[model samples]
Target: MAFGSVVERNVQRPLMRLISMGGAPILQQLHLEERLLRRTSDNWCIVNDGTAPPTIVMGVSGKVSELVEVEPVLRDNVPVVRRFSGGGTVIVDQGTVFVTFICNKTAVTGLQPFPRDIMSWTGQLYDYAFSHRKFGGNAQSITKDRWVHHTSFLWDYDVKNMNYLKNPKRAPEYRLARNHTDFLCRMNEYMPSRSVFTEGLIAALSEHFTIQQTGPETALSHDNDFEPSTKLLSPQDLQDIISSKESSTVQRVPGWPQS
Candidate 1:
């Protein structure tokens, strides 16, 4: 088969590989690096086992008011950061395993735009990971940006637990409190643990793509070398960071019809 044909056969198909990643902040930074890498390399893929220290990450469009319980989260010393991609806010603990695919948009082969081909592709990967289990996974468009497909594996996703965290009545300033309430309440109950899902995704991607399991040594080499531009936040700095972006517009990816 031709190269393109081979890649097309692999799209949404299963592949297995081993990957390890550091804490949540490091993984978030790596996501930024992968975004930059898409501008250059083709054929490269990344699967990160981002099982990290406890942290809360808000999506690019997520309202801080909605995405975090500031007083408690801060008191717990868990860092809250924003990702370049738009999606639902998520909490990453040691139990969560994060992964990402880094390849040139031109090398994406059979997948088309947004929800259709991309969603199918991810669904296949999830299927391979959760193989005989009751866990569930899904994909959605968060933005027009290429190079990354944003997803999460819910290990023990409980409606009551999610509701306790996302209660609208708890925050009057939240914009889509009602929407969040409905979304969490209606979520599936079969969420699997991060490790199980990560293992499955790696296997699926390795079978389908040209898989390369990376270590911290390899991952660090790809790091963006920006200096310590900002100081470790003092209480005032934290307040400023929150205030500066409070009124900013949250970017959203255009949704497409299913394939």
Candidate 2:
């Protein structure tokens, strides 16, 4: 028995690394961690960028004019940021627990090279933590070899804050209405503690891959090239956003498309 255990230890290898972060501004949390995911040679990384203060992040292709109630959002001083990945808009606050699993397809044996497959894999793990409720909002980014799947687990979010967003025109088919609350499931309803939930995640992942619990050599907040999209939302951007809506409202005379 001892010899067999020794042999297993000798052959075992680390298939993933864990880097956990505390709290930070939402924009910095997403941008810096994403940059790390792109630059690192490590194939598999599990990151929890921590729950941020109140902020709304939109998908890369999202037009600020379409997804949010602009004046109310601004009146409330809520900053709107955009992420590089393609996903829907979400309001994040301290009650939101973030868990990210990113890996090259080659790192995990038999893992599919598609987003839905990857999402399914994550859903299975989160299922245990959120056993009674499926209130996780998931998003992903993929490349030929690598993919990132992250989710916002609404633990105990402020119900009132859902007012900041307007119903999107192209709402998900699963979400028949443009309503926000209808789409959310609170984490606290099932999993009482973030720590316990993460512990479950670590144990669940250990079943498939050897997960090494280690901090990154550098911190998540180390200055990076990522800048807040809201910081750059200038007067011209606002004018453009307003004009973008206005142009869509009025019928245009027949004209050739611009280059």
Candidate 3:
């Protein structure tokens, strides 16, 4: 769509769906964001899971073989999900807070639908929520005139889970050759509570975007209208993919974390 047309449509559409995301398959979470970007015209900002079972998620452009130690990941019985966004691999488990903001290019003042611009805006926004430590990672996925830019703020994480990810051939510049534990910082170090921080964030974001609280029931309700070509990859699907790889790849897979 042309820029003018997109802006015009966005002008008429002002509601930003704030969906609560939790306890679902991490791959399913990724696919929902993909669907929202491609299939719907509504603005959405997802405040996702605070914690669930451990899972290792890789960016879409991230090569599974390069970023993951398949054996350790599988042996650990953790689901390895490849997201549709471009970002470094990370392990999601108890205490990881996921925040996503999807909007039209013109939705926010001085904001462009482009990647770098959105990322920059998000960094500032994150700073407002987490002013003490810099946000560890941010990602962008653009479609037509709308884009999804999200960040993961770890509250607390296990050092052992970081071992599932191998040193990537390509990594975020901030990583600076540091391993996972060294690279990311927990949000808990700064914020007293997840609810306190996220609630404050929602209020802060409302200043820039016309957001409205919506239950998860309204999630993908518009999806009956448009569906993407790519199917959501399940844990079993990823496990099979890893199992078929070379023996060397399988050796790195970690045993399932003891419950």
Q: CA lDDT of each candidate?
A: 0.45, 0.65, 0.68
- Which regions of candidate 3 fall more than 4 Å away from where they truly are? 1-13, 128-135, 225-259
When sorted by TM-score, best at the front, the candidate numbers are 3, 2, 1
Which structure among the candidates has the greatest lDDT?
A: 3
Clashes of each: 12, 1, 13
Assess candidate 3 and give its lDDT.
0.68
lDDT of 2 by residue, 56-121 (tens): 878878878788876566555676777767788888888877777777777655569687787666
The sequence of per-residue lDDT tens digits that candidate 1 reaches over residues 54-129 is: 5555555556655555544444455665555555556555434455554444445566656557656666555313
Top TM-score: which candidate number?
3
**Poorest 10 consecutive residues of model 2 by lDDT?**
1-10
The regions of model 2 sitting more than 4 angstroms off are: 1-14, 44-50, 128-134, 216-236, 243-259
TM-score of each: 0.59, 0.78, 0.79
Model 1's alpha-carbon lDDT is 0.45
Off by over 4 Å in 1: 1-19, 22-39, 43-45, 127-145, 156-196, 223-259
Candidate 3 deviation (Cα RMSD):
6.6
Q: What is the lDDT of residue 240 in candidate 3?
A: 60
lDDT of 1 at 190: 40
